[model samples]
Target: MPIHGIGIDILHVPRLAALIERRGLSKLASRILSPVELDAFCSLTSQSENKRALAANERGPTEPIVRFLGVRWTVKEAAYKALYPLRPTWKELTYTSFDAKKGLKPELVYASLSPDTTPAKLHVSASHDGEHIVATVLVEQG
Candidate 1:
């Protein structure tokens, strides 16, 4: 297969945190996360609700959730670059990985926008350090 396009994106963790601070976590999640991703995000955050003392209005997302949002944002941005003009909506794509012990490799689950987009291969890679997250996407034709 030949490479069709490649894109890379980087984001600062605190930048996303600041955004979430201005616009609630749930609101941000719904705008960026696919339905499956929304469910997963909710499940992850709801775990600590019982232990949290501050009301939802006063609390910001935990570090882990911030990191999660960072990854999603950067990866989606990268994918958008790779698939430019084809333009799959945020809800039309999801991310999945397998075997975290072996270093999970990110995969893009894209609902093809058209018949021409099908049978395409998408390779996604993402990583987050203390204050930054980056993702790269490569698109290939069969």
Candidate 2:
């Protein structure tokens, strides 16, 4: 019924690029992604035409790895914010999808699990400012 916890995070794009270069996207994806998430990531990452269009507009690269990782990080932060109030295990919350409404904002969708209660509602908002990615998460219980 009431809001429990709120989490907000900002990620530097250069930092993400460095992580992808050092650890590789596959490993990061496996560690942080669910099957459905993987599918969505793949869909968003694999779309070259879309990437090119975004790139033409001076957005982030057309490569899916960059977009996918960006989305994954946003979801991770959002899930963290949403689940902290419940104090569930880290693995209990799973990210489902990360997408944008247009070319301007980022969105996150996730599922939270616990034996005693049903999944709570997680509201995620994300954006990019060329230099950094920003996300805000809100958690509520009913």
Candidate 3:
């Protein structure tokens, strides 16, 4: 397969948490997440709410929320960087949605690609620790 480009990003959870605290969740979520992503994020929050009381020890009181936002932000930035030359402004590129692969791996779904290009085929990987979240994107050449 031909190589198009690769992009990677690392984000500090504290930085994003601060933004969420300052700007509020609705505003930040609307600006950053695609409709589908927003839905998924909401679902995650709802799930966390229900589970929080049950498993208070296994999950941190706030890390799940912080990590979720941080991972989404990192993945979007990585996708944007991978498509660098064809870069639309961040707001223009709402095409990169995500889903879970069979083994619970995350998959990138690029919906609004240029006509000349084949459907964007992206390989994505992401991870988060208590302090940081990092992601990588591999954009396939068509």
Candidate 1 per-residue lDDT over residues 1-142, each given as its tens digit: 8887898999988889889988988999999999888988887788656567545766677887788778889988999898776788888879864458988766887876577666558899998888989999998865
lDDT of 3 by residue, 41-98 (tens): 7787678779666453344336776676778789879988896676643443343334
Give all TM-scores, in the order shown. 0.88, 0.69, 0.77
* Model 1 spans > 4 angstroms off: 51-54, 101-104, 113-116
Better of 1 and 2 by TM-score: 1
Report clash pairs, candidate 1.
none
Of the candidates numbered 2 and 3, which has the greater lDDT value?
A: 3
Q: What lDDT is reached at residue 44 by model 2?
A: 63
How many clashes show up per model? Answer: 0, 4, 0
Could you tell me the lDDT of residue 48 within candidate 3? Answer: 78
Q: All candidates' lDDT scores? A: 0.83, 0.61, 0.72
Point out where model 3 deviates above 4 Å. 50-61, 88-104, 113-118
- Candidate 2 lDDT, tens digit per residue, 1-142? 7986678878877787777667866576666676666676667655754645544224434444675567557657766766664564333445444436545433344444545665666777767767677777777764
C-alpha positional error of residue 61 in candidate 2 after TM-score superposition, expressed in Å = 7.8
Pairs clashing within candidate 2: 1-141, 1-142, 45-64, 51-62
